[model samples]
Target: MSTTQPQHRSVIDAITAPRDSRVAFSVEFMPPRDDAAEQRMWDAASTFHDLGAAFASVTYGAGGTTRERTGRIARRLSQHPLTTLVHLTLVEHSAAQLESILKDYASLGLTNLLALRGDPPGDPLGEWVPTEGGLNYAIDLIRLTKSIEECRDFTIGVASFPEGHYRAENLEADTHWTLEKLRAGAEFSITQMFFDVEHFLRLRDRLAAADPVHGVKPVIPGLMPITSLRSARRQVELSGSSLPSSLERRLRSAKTDEHVRAVGIEVTSEMAERLIDEGVEDLHFMTMNFARATQEVLHNLGMAPKWQAAA
Candidate 1:
């Protein structure tokens, strides 16, 4: 799929503008670990850009291990036709160190970011230790990002959990924390990957009811189409999210790897359609450094670039 490049706009604007009726779509990418992987990442980014992604994001590694590579790729992506969102976390860096990193991002002209209180370095489910002088929560990180002089014009986004954050006591507690981040200056949020649309709707409703006066900020649903049952199980385990038994049964019933992929695409496309119909303003796809499955889902939804149909 291909198309002429659209006029540049911040993803914030695309999602927030009342007059713009198109549903915004974005993709998330992780930093590549090697030369070959980097090449693959770039190729996938290029294809997604051509396929009309509103923006692209590069993830920060746990413990900030991929800090340099994340910045490099985010800077490069910013130079392309797509607006790039960089992920920032309070994992292994001190307050001073984080400020310096923000300065580097500013110098690189990166204006979009996703602030997070990342997972513990070696084990995500393990105990989390706050860095000596760093922030302890994502809301604090959001405030720190806004405090940067060079980041005055930056659009900050934060993470949300449709199934509730793993460590939160319950969904109510999770929603409260999510509201705190928005009140702290996060302009929008993208949820952790979830299989159930009802989960997202419930989260959205609770947030809306929480802040009836100012209203809730935009919350984009995040999706990862399952191509393999084993990988899907691992992902859900890591995220502390549940896989619906019905969907799992169907996937397990597939006779071969190719059939599994086909089921995944169909399932994801159906979910996307339902969300879009239910008035979701945006959709954030977790690309996993690969684009074919995602591209297929988009195409199946008739949301693929016009050229894809010709191809």
Candidate 2:
């Protein structure tokens, strides 16, 4: 399929004045590590394009490992109809490198960014050692982006954690930092993945209760549908948290691999249904560079597309 650039708007602008009452769904993508994986990623993109994703994301790799790949892919996605957000992370890169990257993005005609303080490269749970002249916090990165001439007017977003940041002293402190980011000029926030819909509801409520105005700005909850038992376990591990015992037990008891995947999809669909019922402005699916699991979940929610028939 060929790409066609369209007039773009900030995600905030799009969400606040939504075209309809329907709860919209967005998507997240990771940098593919090789040509084969890149083709798989493009195939998934084609599927979502047919399905009409609200918006899409391409982000800095863990510890900025895939920095170049992310920028290259983000530029490509921007040319497509999808309103793609390119993630900017203050991980291990120096200030000069970050500036050059931002300028490159601006020159590429990119208009959106999601600022973050990326986890340590080797181990997400490892000690975070900031680069000598790089920023230490996401808020600082947001401010930096705003101060940059080309990126200053770009729509920016920040990351939120429903369970509280792993390194945060408490949930209150976690909320405090997030509020600070909003004050620093982030237009919206996208949350890290969490299983229980209650946690998402609580976090959303907490933000509204914390700052009745800016905190009420659109918050997009992100999740990855478990495509397999092994993938689910790996996600839980990489999250630096444990799965609820019930989910772990259910997955463990599956008699066959197919059963495990089926259970995962069933559980995800149910949770997504609850979120839609809660009336969220949007649901963000971390597609992991594939579409089947997310496609299945959306289908379960009665949002089916004709990609199979049309393509």
Candidate 3:
């Protein structure tokens, strides 16, 4: 007997296709640990869908610890209004395990993925180690995903570091690694959270100068609004990103939660404006499972949905 596979559409094409020539927008979510958190995540997903997000992505936890949760959420999100992207990583699983996970995603009609070499579960800054039968680099995972018969039509996205990955030898090496991933079949990339738009511009210019052809792949800038000072600091430490002194000062000076939120919206809105003016085709917000800040930022940019406007 012969079997048939479902026709798959590429997320890269969905995002890049001109939508009245407007800039595209997307959001990222992390897997929740408990039922309450899962409910919150779904609520946030609903908000993003209603806001007309171009696509949404769920992150894989460090060391693949959240594999089941990530898969469950990805499957659920794929059935939602927005196209969902699942994150795959080489951290603690064997090659066969990875293939099985890919098969599960394929069975759910998911065709978008974000490939990565996940961080160490114990300490992200600690020594890197590969699983006994798993791949090492993200390029290897990208190739593996493509090799899977069920995932042949998947549109893969890889991670990029505008400020250079923490473990990279240098900025030049980091850029080269990003290029390698793109050449290995990653259709596009989303950068680590950055406070300075100039960093993203520099990274884009360097990539463009390096290859001039394949380097032109869409490198969407990632932004996380500073809803809380403590969380912002923690994210900076975790991401190895430098917080701009001015923004840090503003966050520190804000004595009230409301004030801090206002500052965050203002700062992120300003950054978004600058990025849009500089020709960035898309903006990916790290929603952190809270949609209000992201929604406000998009509203400030006049990109919010008509329903939001009416509300």
Candidate 4:
């Protein structure tokens, strides 16, 4: 089906406001797996509100195990008069199931979504399932989403990879996959986390050179502050994003949570600042269910208490 681009305000517009030529900052908050973690989700949401987040997103769990929580948080947060983007997976859903989800979100007044193929549950990761009726990949899901009328109101976003998706053999393959998503109807994209700014810049340049019609979507860069040595390692293992030696050295030398967090915030805030100065389009913070660190990073950058400026 040929779907024209919807008339919603582009995410790029929010990021490139004249006052901030630097990268526009947004946060990606995932729903907690347990009640305690879930409470942290609410606190994070409130903190996001205070940060005057350019946009806020909720993530689906490893196997879509937290779908309900993802939906609930998306609904609750979208009510805050802030931009809310919910993540979804198509690996195990049928077309009927997806339609139901689209309709449910429309009823809840949620209008933005991030379509993901999602991480798999088995030994070989990306071991996706078509769910008898669901989509096999994100591009297929995006195409399915656009087939519905309610989807016209949804600002559909897709995931991108700067270091390249683990499944991709190389950069060229990853670029082809991303372009397919845009042609399928994704309006914009938020990347997986990467520590090196150069990786992002190079990917952006490649996209520009490729010059596809939709032309690489928005390509927002994802930023994850180093909170703990183990946390950093886990992220690297999961996303294949590289870690810089400076960051590794600080994490290795830390003696306490306070020390680690301090080093992390210092390093991350500098990265954020540099990203802005480099003309990055947006900053997507990956909060692994915590607010204090994300808050510290934003505060250090003079962007927190964003509501105060609006007030």
Candidate 5:
């Protein structure tokens, strides 16, 4: 898989588009757990392209287990009509290794990346170990990415947490860190999933106030379609993301997968609609290996056109 070089835009140009603009729609995907699964996932991704997605993502694993595979997929996807954003973590590879990985991506014609401080192995219970010469912060990773003219052309993005980071001293500290990341050359932000809109709006306002110079990137909100009670509860507990009481009640009342999935779809549809109503054009879905629920959410929000409407 190979991609043609992308147009080079300054980081600023890449992030702050005209206000209330509608851009592209995308979804993030993790590598499959096995070869058979990988093939199936690719087939599904291909179908998404045929459905009119603006772009798609391929994720690097927790311990960076699928780094190479992620790159390969990114290259392949970049060749498609859609743009490709490759997720990168700075926790498991040395600076040299990291650079090598980036160079490989560059060679493959990938020009978009999402820099993240990935969950350490056995996350929520295990300690994170930084690889020798690897960055401990996303800002450092952003700076490094910008230093290479060869790779500087990439549209680097950082992760945002609307409800505050998992281990921040406070929301203020999280906001400060986010500023640092932008200053280091992140072109955009993709937020961690949150149930409420206020959290995102508040953070956006706070960040804008703090850094009037660089300006805030278009922090595309992440929308996750909740389909199972067990999964929803687990996600909330693990990420510390709050679930609205009403949503929780609905989930609790759901006795079958269909009931739970329906409730989840309704809640997410409402959220996406409100975001769009607020003038948010770009939405990134955390698909969690299922296509239909995500497809449904986008369709209900009017982002998914007839070609991509849920079947």
Candidate 6:
């Protein structure tokens, strides 16, 4: 017996669609580790439902270790109003396994994905070794996914670094790699999280100035509202980006958790405001499975959330 499939929306079209507000926002959530965490994620999803995120993306664990859990989360969230995007990484799996996962995603009507090469599991900074018969880079995965007819209709996106991925020789080379991924059939790109708005501005300018033709993609700036100075510092370190010293000092001087969260909301709001004023189409928040800070940031920016129609 055959059943009807659920219709999905395109993020490329979502970002480009007309809106009452010039700026739009999206969210990123990590796979929950336990039942309690799972509940929290769902709660966050429900809270942000009215916040009008263009789409919600689920992140994969290092080396694709959380593959099963990530898939389950995506499946659970598929029932929600928000469009869920799954993340695919070629860290330790073979080509056959990757293909099967892609087919499964198609079956579930999750047609949007973020292609990533992933970080080494044990030590994120450790050397990366591509598995036998598996793809080596995100570009390879994008090409392979698009080659499969069933997956050909999927909207593939890749990661970019405003301050340059640590593995790259320089910012120029980093830009080259991002362009290559887009050229390989990635419909759009979202940046790694950064504290400084200037880095994002420079990256945007760099992409446009570097390649007039193929390099430009709908780039969504990824941001994490800093809840804890210590946690934020560590995350930035792992992502190979630096936290602005001025913001760092401000976080350090905050005495209590409440004050720290308030600082985070304030700084995040200011940065987001700057981005909106600069005419960015979308802002992506790396919500650490929580909704308060992101909600506050949107509020501070006078963002009136709506259930935006997905394009």
The most accurate candidate by TM-score is 2
lDDT of 5 by residue, 212-296 (tens): 8644567788888888878888888877788889779888898888999899998988888777777664777888766778778
Tell me how far the alpha carbon of residue 263 in candidate 6 is from the true structure, in angstroms, after superposition.
1.3
By summed lDDT, the worst window of 10 consecutive residues in model 5 runs over 1-10
Q: How accurate is candidate 3 locally (lDDT)?
A: 0.84
Shift of residue 219 alpha carbon in model 2, Å: 1.4
Give the CA lDDT, 0 to 100, for residue 153 in model 1. 73
What is the RMSD, in Å, between candidate 2 and the native fold over all Cα?
Answer: 2.1
In lDDT terms, how accurate is model 6?
Answer: 0.83
lDDT of 6 by residue, 68-141 (tens): 67877777766677777889888788988889989988888889989999887677788999889988889888
Q: What global local distance difference test value does model 5 have?
A: 0.74
Which candidate tops lDDT? 3
lDDT of 6 at 35: 81
Steric collisions counted per model: 0, 0, 0, 5, 0, 0
Tell how far residue 106 is off in model 6, in angstroms.
1.1
Residue pairs with backbone atoms closer than 3 Å in model 6 (clashes): none
Root-mean-square deviation of each candidate, in angstroms?
Answer: 2.9, 2.1, 4.3, 5.7, 3.5, 4.5
Q: TM-scores of the models, in the given order?
A: 0.92, 0.93, 0.92, 0.86, 0.87, 0.92
Off by over 4 Å in 2: 16-21, 62-65, 306-311
Local error of candidate 6 at 38, Å? 0.5
Q: What local lDDT score does residue 198 receive in model 1, on the 0 to 100 scale?
A: 95
Off by over 4 Å in 3: 1-8, 62-65, 305-311
**lDDT, candidate 2, at 115:** 88
Error of 3 at 124 (Å): 1.7
Error of 4 at 197 (Å): 1.0
Q: What is the per-residue lDDT of model 4 for residues 71-129, given as tens digits with 9 covering 90 to 100?
A: 66766665654566778886556778778988887777666788887776564255545
Residue 67 local lDDT, model 6: 62
